[model samples]
Target: MAANPWFSWTYVVENADTLWEHTVQHAVLTVEAVAIATVIAVPLGILVSRIRWLAGIVIGTAAVLYTVPSLALFAILAPLLGIGRTPVLIGLVAYALLVILRNTVAGLDAVDPAVLDAARGLGYGPGRVLVHVSLPNALPSVVAGLRLATVSTVAMVTVGVVVGYGGLGQLMFQGFRNNFYRAEIMAATLACVLLAVVLDVAIWAGGRALTPWRERRRA
Candidate 1:
């Protein structure tokens, strides 16, 4: 009876449905949180670039939020939100905001002042300059930030188990609580690693595709 405590086909075979559900939930949580963060952060980043004074305040707030414990966030939100995925979603988004925001700011700031002047000389207004020049130049940095935030969020989703909506985290945590069931824990852990790798790769490829000129310049 070649039994491995860490993993077993029997466990996977029996829990296939549950595992699939958990994996989907994990992906959903990651996508929703990151997508929401990107939508909020990018525009805010653009605004901040234009309004220098707002940069410190907004980034500082997001930084503070990022430092808060996930469990504490769940606890704080549980009363008003009631429970489950909502709190988790908010927490993940908060966690992701700083990374994306910082990257956006950095990307924009890194753009050449000469380029902005050139756009202005060409009779481009601020909006047109931003849309045509600054953003495209800064896109690679923004893409890198997205990749980092995404990978971080994938790992952070496990913390949502406290609110009963952690996706693969639920399974991973449960296995430990249930007398350290190795196979269950291993499966969930591996699934999370796989999810993170897949998302990171996809984002990287997409970024590369979008920023092909960057490659040409480097070469």
Candidate 2:
């Protein structure tokens, strides 16, 4: 393949199936982590926002977890979880919590007080006002958080290779271990970047769908 050329079409042709497998694994892991984080973070965010006192405690803990070194967190979980996707998923979710939680809380808090009061005046209960009014207004920020978390998760999926489940990371590390095979490494790296971009765009579209009124306002 032209003496290990950086762009070897032959290498890609020969390893297409393996490459596709790794890419699929990478995408799936990213999706799973982000989805789980969203489910946990969103509700926790709502609770903390309502409680006021718990906001710092919960978000601060998530922020601390975010600062824990990714490799170190993965290693710590490995002993307990026994070397697999479980530890990797847990670590990724830990990292995602801060961003998503912060965005959710901020979005909820940013909902106009006057609008909430008006909803109350119209006989809406607190729960109804929050669900029907506050959450919809906060949709953009929450989705922004999700987008950030998803892209970051895609990049972090590579870290899972240490625990034996990093999708494209497997290919990248394989190339590195095999004397820096340019084609394999480049292919994996490019795939990771492209996955992140596609996910960000997808989330942006989702956010738009959730707030079509915002689009109509712009129009």
Candidate 3:
């Protein structure tokens, strides 16, 4: 009788070393893309939130960019960037902006008017108030956005297989090419899932640590 390929540990054991390398590559790609997106999107979000009229245009543009098909984007980008990690990184960054930007805008907008007024009343300059009060208060929302972007990026990185930059996704692709090698496919899928779960938990814990005041307020 044939054993269940999905549950087979053979591929995992056979390819353990390569699997680890691919996992690391996947993690690095995901982290770099998200970090870049956050840096660019957070500031743009703040600017749009501040200049109300610009919000529509900036966000709308991001939305349109986000709506572009991932493969199509890759096809377009591969020509300009020339394969490897650059196109994948650029695509992931583009995919992430909408979530991060909207979250940043929402977070900043959600900051209490009373809190801002109090900071100003205390002689805090606009810049100081934003840094000390507005940003801190809005951090929960921002972190929430980061969590979403992180998970989405993890899933999207698999699409990077289209451009020879799949990371763990490469395992699955190899399995597909090798006649339904379910063990490889399953292992790769499991690794990606586990990575996403771990990242989500870490982000959640970091958010809690950063927003200790929320716990105090509740208490």
lDDT (Cα, tens digit) per residue for candidate 1, span 31-147: 999999999999999989889999899999999999998889888988879779999999999999999999998999999999999999999998899999999999988998999
TM-score of 1: 0.95
- Give the TM-scores of the predictions, in the order they appear: 0.95, 0.97, 0.97
How well is each residue in 51-106 modelled by candidate 3, as lDDT tens digits?
Answer: 99999899999999999999999999999998889999999999999999999999
Q: Assess each prediction's global lDDT (C-alpha) against the native.
A: 0.92, 0.92, 0.92
Alpha-carbon runs more than 4 Å astray in model 3? 1-4
Question: Stretches of candidate 1 above 4 Å error?
Answer: 1-4
Screening candidate 3 with a backbone cut-off below 3 angstroms (N, C-alpha, C), the clashing residue pairs are none
RMSD for all candidates, in order, please: 1.5, 1.1, 1.1
Model 3 has an lDDT value of 0.92
Candidate 2, which segments miss by more than 4 Å at Cα? none
